[model samples]
Target: MQHSLISLSILAALASSAVFAQEQKEDEANDKYTDRIRILGSSDKLRTLGGAASLIGELELESFEFDDINRVLSTVPGVNIREEDGYGLRPNIGLRGSTPERSKKITLMEDGVLIGPSPYSAPAAYYFPMISKMTAVEVFKGPAAIKYGPNTVSGAINLVTREIPEDFDMGIDLAYGSDNYTKAHAFHGETAGKWGYLVEGLLTQADGFKTIDNSDADTGFDKTDLMAKLKYDLSSTNTDQFIELKVSKTAETSNETYLGLSDDDFNQNPYRRYAASQVGLMDWDHDTIQLTHFIDFQSVDVTTRVYRHKFSRSWQKVKGFGNNAPSIQTVLLDPDASGNQDYYLRLSGQEDGKIVVGNNDRRYVSQGIQSDFGFKFNTAHIEHIIDAGIRVHQDEILRDHFEQDFNMLAGTMQNPQNKIFTTVDQEKSTTLALYIQDTIKLDNLTLTTGVRREYIKTHYQNRSDNANAKDDWLDKEFSIILPSVSAFYAMNNDWGLFAGVHQGFVPSSPKQNDVDVDAEKSVNYELGLRFAMQNTSGEFVTFFNDYSNLKESCSFSNASASQCPIDTDFNGGNVDVYGLEANLKHNFALTTDLELPIVFTYSYTHSAFKESFNSDFPQWGNITAGDEVPYMPNHQLSVLASIVHGQWQLNLLAKYTGEMQEAAGSGVELSDKVIEAHTTFDLSANYSLSAQHSLYAKIDNLTDEDHLVSRRPDGARPTKPRQGVIGYKFRF
Candidate 1:
């Protein structure tokens, strides 16, 4: 039959040309990924201008560590966190006035590394990261934090983590809040063939809001964590290799003592436990190891850390009623250990220039072995975009055992001249450095400049006693050269205009278990303005920081009639500070449709101490020059707001602190309330039915208000309370 009609018309024209070549290859792969990953996550003013505390995810992860991350960063307006006798153990973070204890001036990072405090210790410990796998947080204050380097004179916090995307996924979160709190978390990722994996775990427990009555002990908190990551892909130029491991532990039990409200037992029994049944005990542990290598696009890194701590205290159980009541119990401890070994080699790529080299080795038998070398430079010209770096460090500070225990809150039967010895004291040091930076763009104006130069060398050997304590090794060295500048202007397209000036240094911390000292300087100035439309935004600043010679650790005069053994005193002073900071943000798309956020911040801090320290100490006291610097705080305001429709979300936060001075030479008896800033609130909800499933809920300190976040009161300390929480989350 005519060859069956020509083979059925050639099989219907080859099935219509293979269905038009599969619809033209699916419209050219959907126009190259629908606009480059949706312009990298909905570019809202470039994600709030590269986030530096314009309030980012989870409100910039404030809690620093726990307290439910300050119940979600206290709703943002003017953050403030406190915990005197609560669960978060010893927690406090007051923005604006910049309080966060040894936080010095805020500068924390994770992912991008740098865990803070330990440039060679002397009162510097509090990096404490591991926020159960944080995903985002970035805040930059002061002179925009000068790109993260040494406290930045008051701001820089970045904590971003989350990289498991390669397919298969899993997630889990569980919680029970309000006092007995309780938390759990888990995550998993996969990619079998080329090998890729991720694992995470966390557990938390709390049983406190403060409600002890004389002593039953246990105002508790406990934590545990584990993390693992691995990846290896070598598909010809697909190169990649990464391995990560982490371990953590946390514990805090307290009865509270900063000594503020005790006038007849303050409120009769405000979480009271008349000191002594073992008040305040802490145990902390952390471990980390990392190795990464990515090719083509460059990346090489290695990191290591092992930290251990054991602290115990009990100082209040010696009362007499009618027969010399003696029930003795006063204790202290130092079962501690520390370690750090880091090495990095970087050469990032993305069509831009980047290079890095680093080394940091630190051991703690009393702080020794601190070797460093770092360099970096990133470039782009046409429209400018450059970042630079340089660093060199060296150390030999072997003189451990509570630093030859010179009475840091004496004990052991009440200071029998204070005993607790452990020494290595073979001090040797060298720290050479160089730095340079630039960020420029003309059309709409943008400029940033930097410079740094430093050199220091010192040596001291074996000294159980160096006459009055601060030996000046032969011709020890000290040199400094610092400079910085910043500017930005971009009216049109949402406005912008900013200004800056900067300088900072720190070179003293080795009161000669042998030698090393002469490095403490600061100079900073700023002016600013930056605003945007969509999603609302704002940033305004005015600041000044002046510190010279600084260095403090006094107590040498008349060394106990020349018994001279060594009583500590390494003085040098000068300090002047000034500031004004304003930040605002809003994201409202007519309520309930999703996304309604707002944030605000205000600050003013002033300090002085041109010099003068020995009139029974007190006009700010201690390492003198006017003393108000210890944790700076002289008026601050804050606020945060939120509202998210669909699945519910509501948040609000607040903070206010003014007046602070509690160290240097404490004459005691001062209390404009060293730290009295607080306010917090939170709420959350989530529900999704597909794409892996989801359900969530959260509430923290909704209103339980009544606060006093922190106060060392210089010496008699006591102040911390007010807490609440609730949570639940799951995804698969």
Candidate 2:
């Protein structure tokens, strides 16, 4: 079946290319009179690439006041974002059908630079850029993402920050919503002669809606962000050069938890929290500094950047109820079961439960220097655009973890242990990467080919408190080469076709107990078509991924002993994933001179483990041949409609997420292990009071429907209730 699909895709591409060639030849005489359009860093160029890509600009971001990336990304086809925390503090992003845990399978960036705390050593996204402060977002999927990095098995997501403006400008935004949610964002920028500067700050806080039935602690978060940028332009009679310096800081405190309620408890009160999780909290701080230089020449453009980033976080949460007790998830699934009743009673504070609290404290630092050169020239009637880049990076993670035991007395945590136990686990890595790609353009056809080389050296150590315990450092080295090719043909001004195939790569989890593992590798293919007319535009794409090895890591903090040994790894030998994505947008003009815009997006994904032989990982429990990959919905759909008048705009958005299995299984037969399908609607309105003033209002989940969002790491969790916000913006 897969082979037949591949053949049909190839045939379609060839047919389109032949038609394009004939059209080009027919219009040969008028080629000289046609004007060429070029946008250096624009969405049009990205969309026409031989793969699936989408650029969400400021206007689209403001349409619904979507500060949460999951909500904003729903409009894009083939992009899947899982909601963990009600707020998008840490997004679990998946491209195509890759795993979405911690967003580790994909490449994440800010301002075109890798933003992971430790991209090379510990790629878990403990810290994410603030989406409310970003000016734009760029999503690159399929084979084109090979240019980004060592974790491109999925794709790449780039957050574009606000840049220094060419002229003086100032703006302020304020909003208040349900749950006492408040936000304030302000920014100012100016350019004077050869110098330009910008400063921005954001503050947001909320009093959460969920109730801690046994405690008075606020289940909310407070966050602050500050950024500054300086730019200098050096323009002379012979050359042009520019330099930019940027610094940013972020701090956040949230009372969050991974411990959820039992099925009965959830049914009674979906927003209730267990007393054992009263101490669950996360506090973090991040700082970054970057310097970039740009040089422009007659035929080439060069850019160099040097950056350093540091992050520190301390998350204190309930790790376990007792040594011999059932896991939180097991008790939640069947609280009345024989052995689970006792555990459920302990979690409810009716019994003496030795609650284990772990202080997961960690610090990370990443620094790198990278440069990119782009050259454009023409030779033998063919235009060539070549891009090459190289990077050297070093990153590490330092951990100082400790734990304490306590008991809940009369619905209150008491009898805390005075003695605390500690352990250390650290990892460091040094990496070098180089990549080059050339795009060849001839009349109506364009071909792009690229290759990347990566070399990495990693070291890990585990320190024990016992004097007799053995402590030694282990080292490992890896080298990988990846290549890709793609083609795009413009059949005419209104029709086009593209296709590409590339190799995907992802580094294995850090060594565990002196066990070295091989890296995960896959071959990915994509074929798509683009169509645009006077008032309509759309794209349809089909993608397939063949994985040689799929890997999963287990953490003691989240997984139970029955799931997998702590700090162990599980490999799912081979897998196959295929999907289809389609998106369309159209504009209609009314008789009253008003315009209405409609947008539609849909995706279908089918992923399965081809040769499943499971070892002890609960996520891949008793895997069998043709078992579907967990947590990936087979169908997703969204629609948007907007009305535009003189100075007012209104939009209505609706989204549907199909049912999916919560664990690796043949089908969704078990209710506890299935995430049911759900639909949500949103409404937004914006009005311009004047040239410098505007007002906006948004209401999310307008129907106030209750639904389960996830059942992972622990027990089932519900999505946030309806929320409404009113805001005002001022500009000068």
Candidate 3:
């Protein structure tokens, strides 16, 4: 049933795109020529469409509004987006199937700054900057991302914000949706008297669809964000200088759990039922400030930030079975728990063309402790770009006070609280790297090549009161170097083809100690073609990613007892991934002056544990060759079509994912389960009531079809149900 649905959906989506493309061709017969498109990585935006080898490409923000970031990813070939929690905020992302850990494998950047809480933590959580603030997203898969530093072992996603316009412009939008969702956003900007300024703010709140603990529906939360930018024309020679500030706060409350469900359980209590679970609240806030200076061939940039986060939860659970077991198996209850604290820190830096150098020093008393320094150098010579950088980080942890309780007869129970505890621990690690790249321009092709050398070292010391814990687990560390190379050819003015092979590697995670796990590595090969016509444009890419020494979460000896550590070991395994993506856009010169755009994607992945393993218990401890990796499906596809006529536009998108197994399976249950593929349709339109005002209504999952977006091995938890939204926008 699952396979059939997936096949049908893929076929339907392809059919839709084909029809849409034909319609667009009919409309493009007499269309006007579009202006040259420009893609920006830095505010200086000094570079434009020149060579296909550049990290940046021409892109537009208007297309991003059609859907959330994940849905829009189909527009870009070779990129993939996955949603573990289904779009409340923190989304899991992956590209080229570079090890299916999703966000863990990809480095996410907002204006050149990493947004994840801990780059080394498992199940890396990421907030890719609200979609409303971005103008374009520069995606660098495989080796192209090596320049961004660590964690780009898989790829990198850079969220680029809107451009600073010279003319005055202001806009406001308000929206209301099903499930008690509301949002408001506004922005204003202008340039006058040799000075320019811009400010924007957004607020969003929602009362989710599924009810948990009998009330206060789970997934409800509020998120607010604001930003400001100021710029000055130091001299008439276009020597620009700018300052920008960004701030955001998110408060979420819900009765939730970390447990996921199996196929049968998902079909049963899909809403997720936990009698002992009660409403809980969590709060988060972040702030950033950046300063930039630019001239003809030289530019400088600086940035810093202060961040804080707090979380709490309430729940009840039975502790144990005693000799005085109640006649009716009486239940036990306890007070809800809280994991709350504020993370405070400030990071500063400076970078310019004259001499590329920067520093990142941080201070955070909570969420552990950390201090770090970063430096870089860049020198350009005839046909060569030489870049080198290094970072040093040290950390200290603070233990806090806590209470413990349990249940007794008749009802829940609680014991006395434990004593407060504190510990002094120091750890230091450093990453040193150097790279030399040369871009040679021939008749009509550009050949680019670069090789980077990286070295890493770490040492740790601990002074603690816990006698059972070791004073030092890791003694010292060593290093390894990775190399990459690629080339791009402009096969003429309208078409270009680029192909390259690159390597990636990640140092052992701090969470894992005692285990002799080597860094993970991968080699990627890609061939892409891009084309642009007078009235139409499109891009296609085919890629294959191969990985080795893949990391696997497993149990190891700890305190003479076999246990699963936060970080595990590198297992002997290999994975091969391939995919294709294409996007087409065209404008019609019909009487109605309509425009049509179509996009499609197809992906496949295969992986295996190269050998058998046994370290823990018997039955569930062995991993054999040909065992598939979890989460990543063998097949995936998506297609989207949109039409614009006057002030009104309509869009339809559909996606299909093949059946996939869950990670890790004991002997009793199947290693993986099939998720029946599902498809949904969204309808949206905008009507201009006047030159300055407009109204928009969007109905997502229009059919309200019931389906599972993800299947937890435990009991499945249904995501936000179907929804409808109505909104209005005003411009001045």
TM-scores, all candidates, are 0.29, 0.92, 0.73
Question: Best-fitting candidate, measured by TM-score?
Answer: 2
Candidate 2 wrongly placed segments (more than 4 Å): 1-40, 418-423, 468-472, 512-516, 556-562, 565-567, 666-672
lDDT of 3 by residue, 1-732 (tens): 999999999999999998796445422311100000112243221111221221233233343243356654644544444444444365556666654343667766655444544443322442345765566666666555555546545677776555455688998988898877788889899979667788888777777665543344455667677777776655333222233344444333332333333344456656554322221233444454444433221232122222222222122111112223211001101111121000000000011101111111112111211111122233452343333333332322222212132222122122423322222343444445454555555556655666666565554444455674575556556565566666666677777677777777666655446366656777777777766667666656666667676655431101001123223555544655566655555655555587776655556555555566643321124566666555566667666667778777777666666765544333422333445556666566667788999888877666776576543312344544567888888988
lDDT of every predicted structure (CA atoms)? 0.44, 0.80, 0.48
Q: Model 1: residues >4 Å from true position, as ranges? A: 1-101, 105-208, 211-443, 446-479, 489-491, 495-504, 510-531, 538-585, 589-732
Candidate 1 lDDT, 1-732, residue by residue in tens: 788888887887787886676445433322222211111122243322322244355324422224444444433323333343444333345444443544433555554444442333332332255455676555555444544454444455555555555678887767676666677878888877667778777777666555443345555566666767676664343222233333333333333333233322343544443322122333444444434332222221112222222222222211111122111110000101121000000000111111111111123211111111212243553354443334343434344322111111111111212233323354555555555556666667766676656566655554446464445343366666666777677777887767666766544544443243345556666666767777777776666666664443321111111112332324345667676667777887775487867677777677666777643222233334455654556656666666667644555555555544434345432423354444455445555445555454544445655444433321122333444444455565
Which stretch of 10 consecutive residues in model 1 shows the poorest summed lDDT? Answer: 340-349
Summed backbone clashes in each candidate are 25, 0, 13
Top-scoring candidate (lDDT): 2
TM-score of 3: 0.73
In model 2, the number of clashes is 0
The order of the candidates by lDDT, greatest first, is: 2, 3, 1
| Residue-level lDDT for 732 in candidate 3 | 89
Compared with the true structure, what per-residue lDDT tens digits does model 2 show for residues 26-134? 2431121110101114656754588887778888988887877888888888876566667877777788888777777888888778999988777878798888988
Winner by TM-score between candidate 3 and candidate 2: 2
